[model samples]
Target: MTKQHIGILALLVIILPSCSYFDFSPDLRFCDDFYVVVEEMPVLIGGMAELQQKVVYPELARERGIEGRVTVQFIVNKLGDPTEVQMVRGIGGGADQEAVRVVKQAKFEPGKQNGKPVCVQYQLSINFRLEN
Candidate 1:
């Protein structure tokens, strides 16, 4: 087995789930209704240290030499639960699935705009690295 780390970036954070599950269709009005360019981005409830403890590096990924960053896009609702998790880019060999698993289980603080909690789109990248 190897060591891995998860890095997250808040690119294109929309208001919330405006479309169906995993459906990021182009609808100009959707942004106004549910999307929000949040001023205060969501945060992991317990921080990265908590996430690091919960993440399980898939053994399959380690044995197969599948290592890299897996970028996942998802929506964090006003209640801070991640939904509609989507893998924008992945390294494959179970790394993608594992990334999704971690994101789904992880909780956020819920993005805010104008001092009110709102939904937002989120992207997180989990890196798979082999121990030397």
Candidate 2:
């Protein structure tokens, strides 16, 4: 067991295990998440009035005087169904949940690119206003 041989063995052990630590994790660095320009934008079937009418204002929100707008972000699939619905901004007292419920029930006209339907990310803001 020479000192040079011992030194070589130590280097080999330290270097070999460390080499496996690296990983090229998948990422969306090159992804075009949203289309800059599309042939059409996703649109709710009936519009705001319909949504307002459909919403069941949270009783707790009305009682506590909690009122505001909830912003939701979702992907409108090629079939015009909302997917990946997420609450971007929320108001308490169940107003946020009510808004989400109504919005999720909505149907949209899918956005198109080059005359073909495409997944489109859309943001919708729903107001929870207490009627006086």
Candidate 3:
């Protein structure tokens, strides 16, 4: 072969090895039933007396005797702790406080991501009922 042809072949050989170094292989898993079931327990409310005490029953609502529901969202940490409680839906008076207080005081079993327990966002709904 001509020197020029030989040099070209040698250059191709040098470039091929470098190209192999960039080869990527990714791990993949497949399952016929790729479904994972997660069972969530019901969050307990009215368990903390301190939280109950902080709930404000609006005098106006009490006079009118309005009973409603409040929805709150929060994060439960990997340590099975609750934090960042905010009211998504609020009812005037002590209902909102009651919702926040109860949520903050409530404990969670934490949540799982990929079968491992991790911090997760949780939502809670609290109902305020006034007894005559």
On TM-score, the leading prediction is 2
For model 1 the local lDDT of residue 30 reads 27
Q: Which residue runs of candidate 3 sit more than 4 Å off their true CA positions?
A: 1-60
User: Using Cα atoms with residue i matched to residue i, what is each candidate's TM-score against the true structure?
Assistant: 0.70, 0.71, 0.55
Q: Model 2, range 48-75, lDDT digits (tens) per residue?
A: 8998889888999989998888998887
Total clashes, candidate 2? 0
A best-first ranking of the candidates according to their lDDT comes to 2, 1, 3
Best of the two (1, 2) by lDDT: 2
User: What is the overall TM-score of model 1 with all chains considered together?
Assistant: 0.70
Better of 2 and 3 by TM-score: 2
Whole-model Cα lDDT of every candidate shown, in order: 0.76, 0.81, 0.65
Q: Report residue 69 deviation for candidate 1 (angstroms).
A: 0.5
The pairs that clash in candidate 3 are 56-94
